[model samples]
Target: MHGTVFPPIEPSEVISTFFFIVLLFGSFMTVVIANRFIPAVINVSFVKGYSVICLFIAIWEMISFSELVNPVLLPPASRVASMLVFLWSIGFLQSQIYATLYKLAYAFSLALASGVTLGVMISYYSNVFSFIESFATAARVIPAPAWLALSILWFGIGSASAIFIIWLGCFFPIFLNTVAGVAKVEPVQVETIKTFGGDKWDVLLDVVLPTAYHHILTGSRIGLGIGWITVVTAELASPDAGGGLGWMIMDSRVLLDITSVLCGVSAIGFLGVVTDSLLNSLEELVQTWG
Candidate 1:
């Protein structure tokens, strides 16, 4: 039963696997060392939290690979690590990463710009907001996946389709949040600007925008996550059009390469962490400046 469930690993591969494990441990140690020198509360907390998650994942993988569970369905962490190296060595990994990142950047930028602009306009005009509110509410109920077919028909399978899906999924949250934030801006502030001989433009720029900045940032964070999910789903739906992490996961599943699938999942998860952290840092910087 053990032989059938857990195939033998080559000695060289085992040695290399141990080396990889040691490298991970060393990296964790390096983070701990850096944490000691870092004075910022947020930075230290983030490092510690990240380290704990990594450690938990490592332990989980170790236990899963110990023959306590079926290895066929859940390959060892070492196998996934090796698959990652192989993908990188063959130049597929970086290209796919670039493709996904490019689409994400483009779609997220469009959503942010359009959402914020339209939201501000809608908030300023009661008639416009009244006209659009029902449609926006209905659209929010429809899943992003539901638009893939129409997007494919309109954009004809490629980045265009994926971007449209991403933008569609991300836009609502940002737009709604922006409207809420603008509406919540203290009326007294606007009145004060008016009393100072400021025009509507000045009230918007000086009072409304700054007050709503935090809300906009919050919406952006939420929209970014939704955009990432939408892009991956879009890529999976149209794998032939573009190579991305999602495509890699789908291809691995087709080939029955569970290790490769796991690697792709890990890559996506890691990238999400990095992107979220960067955005959080940006939020902190903005808060300080404001």
Candidate 2:
């Protein structure tokens, strides 16, 4: 099957694969060594975390080389890694990454702004919460993919449609967390603010936001993760919106290009880790502010 699917691996391919392995483990060993000597080298957690990753890659290569699975279905780690390098070299990866991130940024921004705003309003106003709570609950029960057709219909198969779907996926988690955050703010603190001749705005600014910063950041992280997943789904469904990593995956699937599919999937996974790490850093920073 491998022979029929991919041309026979040439000598250059073997050499390339050999160097890819050396580079991969060389980088890992470098980091591991640095972690041993450098106190400032990425904390113990990252070092330990990456060790597990390296182990997984080693296991993956073993299984692939042993032909434990069909190579066509589960390509070798080396091939996938090389494919990633190849895609990046050709600029395809960057363009698709930009497209996906572009849609994600717009959708996530909208979700953050509107979610925080409405969440604050609902938390403060019983009437507003009463009116919207049921509707939000109902909408939240529906999966993000269910909105694909409707979004495309409303926005017409383009970036707008993709953005709307991502926003929908992101909004509820953020809104709920924000409301919870505000609700958790102590009545004593609020009352104290009022006793000090503070108005509602002063209470909101001084007591509510500061108390809710942690929760809001938590929500943003969760929403960003959901937004990332939703953006891929949106792009997969809205091919007319132009190129994106998800679109690239679906397109590759059509051509039975498993390597390309893996490349896209790997890119998404890498980006997810990077974004989550960044948000985690922000969350930690926000905790310090408290």
Candidate 3:
């Protein structure tokens, strides 16, 4: 009887794997050394957050080593990390990330521009809003993902479809927030501007936009979060997303490569965290400006 044969690993792969192993071990050691020197490090919010991550990794490692669950279903964290490193080394991961970000950027930019414009029009001209309100309400009632089928039909199974889905997901929150912000501006402020010889431009520049800026940003942040989720969903469903983390996950799943799937998931999580942090910083900056 012939036993199953495995492909020979390349020397470069061996070197890369060894390097990643050393990095992982060095990271763990650094954490341990830091813990020894700074017992109160965990008291800091950032450190506490990382501690939770470490705890999760520790639990996952234990579960993998203990074989309490099928390894195929839940691969070890090390394997996932190594897979991520290997993919990055091959430049495949970077291309996927770029594709996803490019689609997201186009979608969210369109949503922001149109949402804010329509929101302003709606806020200023109640008649226009009255005409559009019912339709808007009906559309908003439907979830973003529900539009996937129609998006694919309309735009076909490519990045266009994914962009449409993300735009749909991001538009409503931004529109609603802009309307709410504009509406919240006191009528007295508008009157005051007009009474002081201010034109419509003055009302818009001095009162409306400044008042609504924070709300718009808040809505943008919410919309962006939704966009990320929608983009991933679209990529998973639409085969012609070109390439993306979502596509990577789907491909890995089909091949039963759980480690690559986890790597994709980790990439998404890392991107989410980074983007949210940047948005938070922007929000704070706006607050300070105000």
Candidate 4:
């Protein structure tokens, strides 16, 4: 009963969620239309012609699997819609989304801070960068679940473990990107700045650093993504955090709750898409400046 309240299956609420989802998707379509379709119609560029294609996919998912999917194993889209509608009516929709976001926030904050600081230092100082880069490479190659156990040992079984897992999971991409960005700064730009009485920070600010902004941003974005992935595992491994999306997923699986599983999957994917889009916007801004 507490489980029902804790990680409720509100696939019913997804019906109302259409207001948010469809409107957002419509905005994306508007862009595709503006960027690709409109120009092509004016004989400027080739149209993507894929929005309608995706719509067709929705149609096929509803029709093709409606009766084919067993209720226990794979609920119909209609059922998932019903569950969404149910959840939305109770006002638990936003909370459901928040559950996942909470874990991500804890994980990303640490990884970004560590990665950027270390990356900048390494980029400017070759010796320091080599040592840090070597360690980051080792950490990245290690299995994430193993680190979750280690984190639990160090930080208990709740947010601490989850945060540590996420931190370790995302550290590599950000660190590597930062180092690469620092190392790849244009030599001529550094010289140009140096010739103008620029000190280390001035050269970095005016010349060397700007060149690597794109790479740095890319690393940070990837780190955020990996952190999300790691939190799911961490939550499962940590007994006390039996309230996160990962735990919610673990519980749903125990009860054979396919719709809830799908719901969690959808929510995570939604967040990921939103996050990537925001990062891309930042990257574009950096490029404009760079």
Give the top-scoring candidate (lDDT): 2
The clash count of every prediction, one per candidate, is 0, 0, 0, 16
Give each prediction's root-mean-square deviation over alpha carbons. Answer: 3.7, 2.8, 3.6, 5.6
Model 2 residue 230 CA deviation in Å: 1.0
lDDT of 2 by residue, 1-290 (tens): 54567623211333244575677689888888888888585678877888888888878877777799987788788888777777787788999999999988888989999999999998888674587888989999897878899888898877888888889999999999999899899999999999999999999899999988888888999899889888888778768865799999988888778878888999999899898898899888877877
How many steric clashes does model 4 contain? 16
> Candidate 3, residues 143-239: lDDT per residue as tens digits?
7889999988898877988899899999999999999999889999999999999999999989999999999999999999999989998889877
Better of 1 and 2 by lDDT: 2
Better of 2 and 3 by lDDT: 2
Candidate 3 backbone overlaps, count: 0
Ranking by TM-score: 2, 3, 1, 4
The lDDT for every candidate, in the order shown, is 0.83, 0.84, 0.83, 0.67
Task: Tell me how candidate 4 scores on lDDT.
Answer: 0.67
Which candidate leads the pack in TM-score?
A: 2
lDDT of 3: 0.83
Which run of 10 residues does model 1 get worst, by summed lDDT? 6-15
Candidate 1 Cα errors over 4 Å, as ranges: 1-15, 36-51
